[model samples]
Target: MMTIGMIVMLIASVVMVLASFLSKKTTTDREKSSPFECGFDPMNSSRLPFSIRFFMIAIIFLIFDVEIALILPMVMTMKSSNLMIWTSTSLFFIFILLAGLYHEWNQGALNWSA
Candidate 1:
């Protein structure tokens, strides 16, 4: 068994080396070598100005995504847990999420238009 394992390892190593050599590019194209950036020049400074509104919206999305992950487990546990306790806990969590969304709406963080 040990001899078979060693033979397999040796074969794998040789195949990987051959594959690596064969896969390497012999010639590089100027267009292919340059980074593609939605028609933007690749040589230019990459530190372009970003929209604060877009960033805020992304953060909001991530927060809600995480909240959804947390809520899914609660759903799975509902069958085994006490009905009254589970219902209250789920309601409280949902209420908090709604309150946060309302707050963001009121603060104009959710608004797309300036």
Candidate 2:
């Protein structure tokens, strides 16, 4: 036995379903698929070159953000008997990070408008 609220919900759901069914229609061609923004045509082509800054920031974000994944397993498992393993892993991670940073610095990748 459904409560009154449940019955109302069912009716609303059925109405929504019918509305969606009426709204949906498959179409093809330019009239069906043109840019619709403020009733104005788009000025730029899709092939336009985007700013290098966008890609640079994205690569930097990917490099620094990945260390979280490297550290997470060790943090969760807490698997440490010999300090050397943890110490070496940590130093290795830092070494690689610094090396990459140094390379970027030398190559002027870190510089603005380079």
User: What does candidate 1's lDDT look like per residue over 24-74, in tens digits?
Assistant: 999999989987999788889999899877888899999999999999999
Per-structure clash totals for the candidates: 0, 0
Alpha-carbon runs more than 4 Å astray in model 2: 1-31, 35-40, 75-79
Query: How do the residues 1-114 of candidate 2 rate in per-residue lDDT, one tens digit apiece?
Result: 569889999999999999999998776667557676665555555475787766766787798889768877766555654568777877798899889878876776677766
**What's model 2's lDDT at 24?**
80
Give the clashing pairs for model 1.
none
User: What TM-scores do the predictions have?
Assistant: 0.67, 0.57
Off by over 4 Å in 1: 22-31, 72-79, 102-108, 111-113
Candidate 2 to native Cα RMSD, angstroms = 6.1
Q: Pick the candidate with the highest lDDT.
A: 1
